[model samples]
Target: MFVQPMWLVMLSWAVLFVGLASTAVVVVDQFVLGYRQPVKVMEMVWPVNALYLGPAAVLGYRKWGRPQSPRWLDRHGSPPRRSLNARTTIKACHCATHCTLGVLIATPVTYGFGLEMFGSTLWPEVVGDYVGAAAVGVAFRYYTEARTGGRRAWAVMRKFFMRDLLTVSVFEFALLGWLALMHFVFFHETLRPNGPVFWLIIQAGLIIGFFAAWPPTLLLTRRGVETELLSTPQ
Candidate 1:
């Protein structure tokens, strides 16, 4: 009896739906309200994503650990250099779709769903924040391929590690920085208990965000090994 990899598919599907739906909701709400409430929307959508994604990530890593998902990776690595061919297109779609979803999830979890939002009855905010983090994953894959080259995604990931790292690091810091700044300047709230120490803490957060965003950025890029493993499944 051949065991199916349906679990992976299901998890990916859930992530895709949650991300697209959340992003759509935010877009619609913004159009209706006539403003860019990126943070509020993230707070609502990302938490739910994190709930599922965190587990999915663990399961996926375990399933693909050491051995790795050879089949998935092979589709990316195989040569003969096909352009938007059916197989290649699907692979690209998978990379782009899930990555975009990942980014959408990461954003809110880091910025909004901290201990402060813990007791608030606004559960949507918590849910949305993690969803945004997942979106970060999606965005990372999407932008890397789109900006570089889809067919050569793996190669680009390998050769341009620092460049890719910089891209995602900057993105993570900018979004968090913007959110923190808004809270401090507009809402007059401070993360630091000490007023004078607040600026230092914010600077530290900017630094941490870059660090947190780096590993995942590196993982997605380095996962190119998975392509080689996939094609020559051991």
Candidate 2:
């Protein structure tokens, strides 16, 4: 029997705690605060961001997560709210969140299964990351669209698939590119799928991918391929 390294174990626990804590914040905000009006995608995105960014993500949410109602009364007898473009940032954040989470899940699973199934090939990890990210991204899009009702299942799925493919691909490309550089150039060590260093690297990649995916998201929104998924406050 072999004993695990203390550092590795500590890092693993840290990752687990951060991921869980971030998820908890988003869930509570969505269900308890009744901020579930817009699309549920944001709820998912926030927690995922929190997973990587930790307290910073939570702070951002407190500052900019929900639309701000105006202090002055409007002609409609309610305060005016922020424009949809403001929330578009949140939407773009969702793209990054889903892709990052997918990759995080896929890397270790594929690494383990691939070692067992294929006996030490890198392809399994690569393929798994793409497949997982694409699957999650498409699923989230479909769920958001489906909740709107009045659309056929096949139609909703197809629309989401087409819309998400390019964006998700871009996100993965940026993320993997950075990770590859880290492993091959800077670290000069074999990549450890479950290591804490791997996760910290992934967090940096996620931030990079978020910026990379933003333009495409904005374009999609402008082209009408993507719309506001969040519900308006009643």
Which clashing pairs does model 2 show?
Answer: 37-231, 38-230, 38-231, 39-229, 39-230
- Compare the candidates by lDDT and give the number of the best one: 2
Q: How many angstroms is residue 177 displaced in model 2 relative to the true structure, after the best TM-score fit?
A: 0.7
Model 2 C-alpha lDDT per residue in residues 1-234, reported as the tens digit of each score: 234467866885687578669768866876776545254566667777887777777776655554321211222343235355645566666677667768777776866665533443344655667788767766776676565563566776576567766677777788778876876576654556656666667777887887787788778777777533544433
Query: What's model 1's overall lDDT?
Result: 0.37
The window of 10 residues in a row where model 1 has the poorest summed lDDT is: 225-234
Clashes of each: 53, 5
Models 1 onward score TM values of: 0.25, 0.73
lDDT of 2 at 134: 68
* Local distance difference test values of all predictions, in order: 0.37, 0.65
Model 1 misplacement above 4 A: 1-103, 107-160, 190-234
lDDT of 1 at 147: 30
Candidate 1, position 153, lDDT: 53
